[model samples]
Target chain A: MASGEAILAHGSAAKRPGSPWLSGFVAATISEIKSLYREPAALAFTLGQPIVLLVILVAFDFHTTLPNGKVVPYLDVLVPGLIAFIGMTVGLNGVLFPLSRYKERGILRRVAATPMPTGSFVVAMIVSRLLIALAVTLITWIFGVYVFGADLTGSAVLLIAFATIGSLAFIALGILMVAFARSEDDVAPLMMLVLIPSILFSGAADRQPRPRPHRPRHRYPRPRHLVRRRDHPGRLALQDGVARYE
Target chain B: MATIPAPTRESASHTAQPPALRVANLVKHYKKFEAVRGISFDVQPGEIFGLLGPNGAGKTSTLEIVTGLRDATSGSVEIFGIDIAHHRAEARALLGVQLQESDFFDHLTLKEQLEFLGACYGVKPDTEALLGYVDLADRPNWRLKQLSGGQQQRFALAAALVNDPPLVLLDEPSTGLDPTARRQLWSLIRRLQAGGRTIVLSTHYMEEAEELCDRVAVMDRGVIAGIDTPLALIQQLIDTGFKREVVVRDATLEDVFLHLTGNTLDGVSLDDARKED
Candidate 1:
C-alpha cells in the first residue's frame, strides 16, 4: 500500500514532463520496427523482393541502347528503378497496411488513450518505414555493385538522397490512403489499384516496347519519372567523361 | 470477501481532497443519435465506482468521454481537479485506462508491451513488479496473442497501471471470462482498491457490481436510474414491496459450480497452490 501511494504520488508529480512527445515518438518508432521485424511477409516483400529482382534482371543480361548508339548494361537503369520500387513498396504497404490494421483493431485508440499525441504516432510510422526503405536500398546497391559488377558510376550520396525523398513521398501517399480506408480489408484492394498501375508504368521493368513515334511517352503514368531523371544526369556526366578519356 | 475495509461515501466526502472524478451534465451526440443524455456524477477519492447498464445504455460512451477518448457534446469532466477538455494530457497523466477490447502491438512480448507503455507515459516501470502484480511473472515473454482470455484480461489491467495512475478506468474488465476467472478478477480488483487507487468500472453483471463497487450508478436509456450503495439500492427496491418470485437462497448456481469444481485458476499449478498453503 505504501508503494502504491508512492507510485500515485510520482505519477501525479510527473505530469507532462518536458519532451514526453519526443519519447513517445521514439517508443512508437522502436515498436513499429520491432513489429516489422517479426513479420516475415513484410521482410520478404521489402528486403527479399528487390534482391531477387536484381538477380533475375542481371541474370537475363539485358542491355539498353543510348541515343548515341552506345549500348549500356541495363543494371545501371534497373538499380535506380529497383530503389524506387523498394521505396514505393516499403512506403505504401509498410504504412498503409499497418496503420489501417491498427486503426481497425483499436490499437490506435488504445494508444490514443495514453499521453502520447496522435501526430507523433503518425510521424513515427513514417520514420520507421523510411528507415527500412533506406536499409533495403543500401543492401540492393551494395549487392549490385559487388556481385555482378554493375556499373553505378553515379554519386552514392545523390542516390541515397533520392531514395529518402522518394520514400517519404510514397509514405505520405500511404497515409493518405489510410485516411480514406475504412478498415484493413479495404486497404488491400485500394493498394492493388494504386500499386498495379504504378509498377506497370514505373518503367522499372522496362519490358514494354518503346513508344511508337506518334504516341507520347509522357501520357502514360511515370510514377518513377523523378527516379529515372535523377539517375540519368549523374550517369550521363560520367559517361561523357569516359568518352573524352577514351 | 474483501480483506480491505471499503471506504464509505460519508468518510470519503469528509476528506479535504477533491473527488477523483467529477462529471457535470456530460452529453455525447453521435451524428444523429444522442448516446449520453446529460449525465452527472462524482466519484469520491479511493472509491470503486461502478457504472452498470444494459447494452447501448451509454456506459461505454460516458467512460470514453471521461478517459478523453471521445469529446462530450456538452458539459465538463474533471479528473482530480484538472478539467479534461482543456488539459487532457495533464488529466491523462493521473489516469490509467483499460478499454473493453484490449488490442496491443502484435510482436511485443508481455514485458516489452509494459515497457513500451511505460515509455509512452515518460516512465520506466518496474516490469518484473508489474508482471508479478498481474500474476504473470512466469510468462513475461509471452505475447498478448499467446495468452489465454483470462490472462489477457489480467495483463490489460497490469498495462493500465504502467504509470501507476491514481485513477483507473476499466470498461467491462471481466466481460468474457469464465466464472472462476471472473471471481479471480474480482479479487484482483479488490486488491487494487486495497492499494489505495480509485477505480471506475463499467459492467452489465450485477454480481460484479455488487462484489467490487462501493457505490454504483445504474444507467438506463443513457440516464442514471439510481446511484447509491448496492445495499441501499436493494433496500430501496425491497421497501417498494418488490417480492421475488423465487425464494432467496444463501448459495447461488455460481457457488454450486465452484463447490463442484475446485476454485484453483486455470494456469496455476498444484505446486503453486501448495506454496499458497
Candidate 2:
C-alpha cells in the first residue's frame, strides 16, 4: 500500500469528533480492567479489601446507638463510608500508581509518542478508575443490603450520586498528588498523608459512633449519612442549573 | 538524490513541499539544564535517518518534540507538513514511535496489546499480518514479560506499525540486545524502510549508523555537530588528510563470531517456538 494511503486509512478515523477520544477512553478502560483481572493482588486490594472490611464489621456484630434512641447496624453506616473509602483507594491507586508506573517504565512516554491526545488519555484514566470505584460501590451496596441486612432507607440514586461525586473528588485529588510526587515510591507517603485524613474526616471509619439516648437537644454527627447531607445541596443546585438550561 | 538542505531560518517556511519531518531551531530547557539547543534538520521521505549521539546528547529530546511527547522551549517541528507543536494530533497520526524501553501491559497478549494501541489511534490493526511480519505469529498469545529481550523488541516494532504510520521513530531499538538480536532488529528496520516507511532512528552504535542510515546527524551537548550521509562524512574526513592508524580488515572479529556461531536468532527459549524466518 502507498504510505499516504496507509496514513489516511488510520488518520481519518482519528478525525471524527469525540470518537477517537472515546475510543481511547474505552481502550484504556478495557486494558485496565483486563490487567486488573490478571493481577490477583490488585483485584484483592481493590475489590476484596472493601469486602473483607465489610465482613469484619458484620462478623463482629458491630452496632452503634444513634441519637434517636434507635440502634443502627454498623454495616448501615460503614457501607456508605466504605463507598467513599472505595473512592479513595480506587481513585488513589488507580490513577496515581498506574500513572507513576507508566511514567517510570516509559508506558506514558510510549503512548504519548503516538497521535493520541494527552487529554483523552487522562480522561480515559479518570473514567476507568471511576468505573472501578463504581464497581466497588455496587458490590458494597449489594453486600450491605442482602448480606448484612442493612436498610436502604435513603434513595438509591442519591447514594449513587454522592458516591459518584465523592469518587470524582478523590480522583481529582489523586491527580493533584501525582503532580506533587516525583516517583511511584514518593506517592505512598503522600497518598497516606491525604488518604488517612479524608477517610477519617469523611467518617468512613471514624473513632466515634454516637450512642443512643432519648435526647432531642443533642445532634450527633453521623459519618455515613454526612455524604448525602453535605453533598445534597450541591446536587440540587446542579439539577437546578440543568433544569434552567434545559 | 536527497540533499542535506542547509539549515533554514527559524520560522521560515520552505519554498518546496515540506519534507516528511522538519525540525528547526528546536530547544528544550529544564529548570537549569538545556536539553536541546537550537538544532535543525529535515528527513526526506523514504529515507532511514539516524541521530548519532551519546547519552544526554538531546537526540531523544529532539525526537520527543517532533513526536509531541515533550514541548520545545522554542522553535517548531513539522511532520508531513503539519506543525507538531500546533497540530499535534494530526502530526502524530503520521508518526509511530518505538521507545528504547519496551513498555507493554504485562498481562496483555500481543494481539490484545496491539488491539488496545490500535483503538487508541481509532483504527483496527491487522493483527495477523503484524504478527506475521514481526515473526511472532506462533506466539500471539504470549504475554509481554514472557518474551525474551529480542522478542519484546520485535513486539514493540510490531506495535509501532499497528497504525501503518508513514514515519516511524525508533529510539535505541537495539540497546540491550545480543549481537544476533541486534542484527535481527536491524533487518526488521531495513524491511520497514523497504516497505516505504521513513524511519528516524537514534543510536550510539557507529556500525548501526553507518550500515542503516541514509544520513546521519551527529549531536553533542544538545546541538547538531554535523549532518550528512555516512559515505560523504567519511569521504570528507579522508579528503581532509585524516588517516586511520590501524589497517582496516575485510573479515572483522564480529563477522568471524557470526560465522563460527550460527547467525540464527535464538527463539528456543520462547516456549520451544522457533521463528518462521
Candidate 3:
C-alpha cells in the first residue's frame, strides 16, 4: 500500500521499553515527574495559571446577586473555576504542551531510544500529571474549605473521581491537539485560543444548567458516611452572616 | 561514485582487529524500500569508528538498530561478546549512545541532567568529573535554554558517559559546531578514547572520518560498499606505488574566522538571552 500504511504496519510490532513491574513502574513514575519539574517554563505556566485565577476570584469581590436574592457567593463562583483549573492542568501539561518540543528537538525519539519499557513513557507522563492535578485539586479544596467555605454535599470519593475523569477527558483532547499541532510555535496559540474556550463551554465553570448523569441513589445512600469532619457549608453560612461579609 | 576496493587476503590482514562491535547481515525496511539493506562490519575497541554515508543511505537507521533505538528486521548486533537480540539491557548497559537528537527539561541544570541520565543507566558517577571532562563544570547550574548549542552538545556527551560505558555512540556530534568548536570537540573525543572508550560515530565529513576514525564503513543506499581503514580505502583507488598525499593544506576560512573572532561564543549575546534575573 502507501508509505504511511507501511510505517503503521511496522509500528504494530513496535518494541516496548521495559517491564512494568511494581518497583520499576514506580521508578518510571518518579522519573517522569522529575522530568516535568525539570521543565521550568511548562511547570510555571501550567501550575501558576490556576493559582493566579484562584487568588483573583477570591480576593476580588463580585457583587452579583443570585436569582433567589441571595448574593452569588465567591465560593460558589470559585467552585467552577477550580474544577476547570484542575481539568486544564492535567490535560495540558504534557499532552499538547511538549508535543512540538518533542517533535522538533527529537525528545520523543530520544525517549523512545531508552530501554524503559514500551508504554512507560506515556504512563509516567500521565501518572505525573495525575499526581500534580491531585495536588492542585487538594490546594483548591483547602482554599475553598478554609478561605471561602465551599458547600461540597456529595461524596468526597465521587468528587475526586469526577474531577479525575474530567482531567482524563481534557488530556485526551490535549493529545488530539498535539496531533494537529505541526510546529513548536503552533502549541501556545492552540492552547490559549482553542483548548481553553472549548473547556469553558463544557460547563466546568458554572455548574451551569448542563445535563449530568442522574444516578439513582439507593434510598439509604449513606451520604453521612462520606465525610465526618466539620464541613457544613450551609451551617457555616448561617454562622458567618450567610455570604454577606466575605 | 567511489570505486569498490577488492582486496586480496593479505591486504585484509593489516586492517583486521578484534571486533569491539559486530553486525551480521542486518536488514531493515519500511516496506518495499529497504532502509538498511544487508550491511555488516566490525569496530575495534578503544578506536573511534566512523560510519560515513550520504543522507538517506541508512547511516541513522543502522545506528538506531545497533544502539537499541530501533530493532532490526532480522540481524544481530553483538557488543563485547553480548548479543543485543537476547541480552539487550546487558548489551545496552555496556554501550552509551549520544542520539542524533534529544530533549532536556528547560528548568534543570546541566548537573541535574547528568544525574537523571546516569540514573537511566543505573550509574552512580561523579557528575563533577563528567562535567570537567566536557569543560562545563562552571556552568552546571545553568538551564538548557541558557546554554549555547555547542555547550548543549557537550553536556549531552557528558551524560552519555555517566555510566562510564565501554562503548559510546556519537551521531553527528560535530555537525552543527563551528570550526573552533569542532576542533575542541575533536580533542575531547580523543581524550575519551585515551580513557579507553570505544566510540562509534556517524558523519558526512570525509575529512573528519579520515582524521578521527581508525576504521571506516562507507555506506550507500542502506548498504555497506566498503569497510576498512581509511588508508586502505584510499590506497584501493590508487593501483600501486602509492605516494602519501600528506601535504597540510593552509588553514582554511574557519581558521581565519577563529583568528578574527576568537574561540569563546561571545559573552554579550548570552547576557541578552538570559531571561531569568
Candidate 4:
C-alpha cells in the first residue's frame, strides 16, 4: 500500500510513442483474437464443422455429374462451396454472437470510455474476424487439395480475393444483425434462421437434392453460383482456372 | 467545513484552478422518463466526492453521462477545464472509470487485460505493479471468469487505473466485498488521493461515505436532496431535533470483525507473496 512512488514511476514510464488510434486498433485486434482462441465451442463450430463435413463426404465416396455428363468426385465441387461456407459462417456467427455478448455485457460501453475511437474498435473486430475466417478457409483448401485430390485449379489468389470480399460482406451483415438484435439471447436463433437454409440450399452441403428433370429450378443466385459465375473479373479468373474440373 | 456551499459556476470562476469535475444542470431523458433532473455539483481537485443514493436515484445515469458513455438531454460537464460534450476523447483521457457491472474481454489474462486497456490509451502500464496494487499480482494469468466476485471487482479497479488518469469514477466499488477487502479498498482509495488524484464514487454504504468522503451529495428521485460534508449533514439533523432511540456502541460490527480477523486481505500479504516469487 505504500508503493505510491512505484506506481507513479511506472505510470510516467508507461507512455508509448504513437497515435492512440493506431495502438488502440492493434490492441483491440489482439484482444479479439485472444477471445476467439479461448472459445472452444465457437472455434469447433466454425472451423471444425466444415472439415468434419468434408471428411464425411470423402469417406462416403460421394460423386456428382457435371453438366457435360462427366462423372466427378463431389469433393471437387464441394471444396469451393465449403470454402465459401467457411467465410459465411465465420463472418456471420463469429461476428454476431461475440459482438452481441459484448454489447449485452457493457464491454462496448466500457471501451467507449477510453481514448479509442468507436470506429477503430469496430474495424478492429471486423478485421480480426476476417483473419480467422481466411485462415480457416486456407486450411480447408489445403486439406482438400492434398488429402482428397480435389481439383481447385482455381487461381489461389483469386480464391483468396473472393473469400475476403465474401467474408467482408457477411461481416457487414453480421453487424447489421447485431444492430437489430435485442440481446445476446436473440442472436443464436437469428443466426440459425439465416444459417440453416444457407447450408441446405446454397449448395454448400453434399445431400442437397438436385432439381428433377421436369421441375422448375429456383432463379435466385445461390452462393455456389455466385462464386462460380464468370462475369466479374475475380470470379471470371476463378472460373477460367476451375474450367478443367468442369 | 460546516457551511461550505456546493460550488456553482459563478463561484468556480473565481477560483485560481478549475474544479477537477463540474456538472451544471445535467438532465437525462429516456423517452418518457427523466433519469436525471437538473443536478449540479463540482468536485475540487484531490478530494473524494461521494454520491449517496438509493436504487433508481439516477446515480448510474449521471455517472454514465459524465463518463461520456451516454448522452445527456441537456447539460454540460467539464473535466478539469475541457468540455466533455465537445471534447469527449480528451476528457476521457483524464478519467479512470469503474462501472457498476464490470465486464472485460472474454479470454485475456489479468495482465493482458491491463495491457490492452493501457494500449488503448497509448501507454505501456506496468501490469505487474498494477496487479500487485490490487492484490491480484499472483493471479495475473487468471482470466476474468476464473475470478471470484471480489477478485473481479479488485481487477476492475486495477483496469481503471491503467491509464494513470487524474480523475477516477467508481460506481459502487465495494458493494459485494467482505469487510476486510472493503477496508483494503478504502486504504487504496486514500493512497490514490494522496497521489493527487480526484475520486468520485457512488455507494449505498453510509459508513463508507462517512469514512472516506470529504463531501457527499445525497440524491433521491433524480435530484440531490442535500449536499455537504457527512458530519454537517448529521449536525443539521441533530439541529432539527432528530435523535436515535438506540444507544450508540463504541465500535460497530465491522470493527469487531476486523479486530477478530487480521486486517490483511485474503488471509495473506500479497506483497510478501510477490517478493517470495
TM-scores for every predicted model: 0.86, 0.83, 0.73, 0.86
Top model number, lDDT: 4
Fraction of native A-B contacts kept, per candidate? 0.38, 0.42, 0.14, 0.55
Candidate with the greatest DockQ versus the true structure:
4
lDDT of 1 by residue, B79-155 (tens): 99999999988899788999987599888999999877877777777777677766787888988988889889988
Candidate 2 lDDT for residue B28: 96
lDDT of 4: 0.79
C-alpha lDDT of residue B103 in model 4: 90
Candidate 3 has an lDDT of 0.65
| Residue clash pairs of candidate 4 | none
The CAPRI category of model 3 is incorrect
Give the per-residue lDDT digits (tens) of candidate 3, residues A1-246.
Answer: 011121111011122243323333455567667766766876686567665665554443332333454444445556655765677756775667665666677766655554445365566666777777776787777666655555555677877888888777767677677777888788888888756687678654554321111222223312221321433222212223344222
The sequence of per-residue lDDT tens digits that candidate 2 reaches over residues A133-186 is 999899988877666556557888998998888888878888878877888999
Per-candidate interface DockQ score: 0.31, 0.24, 0.12, 0.41
- lDDT head-to-head 2 vs 3, winner: 2
Candidate 4: stretches off by over 4 Å: A1-5, A8-13, A200-246, B1-15, B250-256, B267-277
C-alpha RMSD in Å of predicted model 4 compared with the true structure: 7.7
What is the alpha-carbon lDDT for the whole of candidate 1? 0.79
Q: Is candidate 3 or candidate 4 better by DockQ?
A: 4
Write down the lDDT of every candidate, Cα atoms only: 0.79, 0.75, 0.65, 0.79
Q: After superposition, how far is residue A164 of candidate 4 from its true place, in Å?
A: 1.1
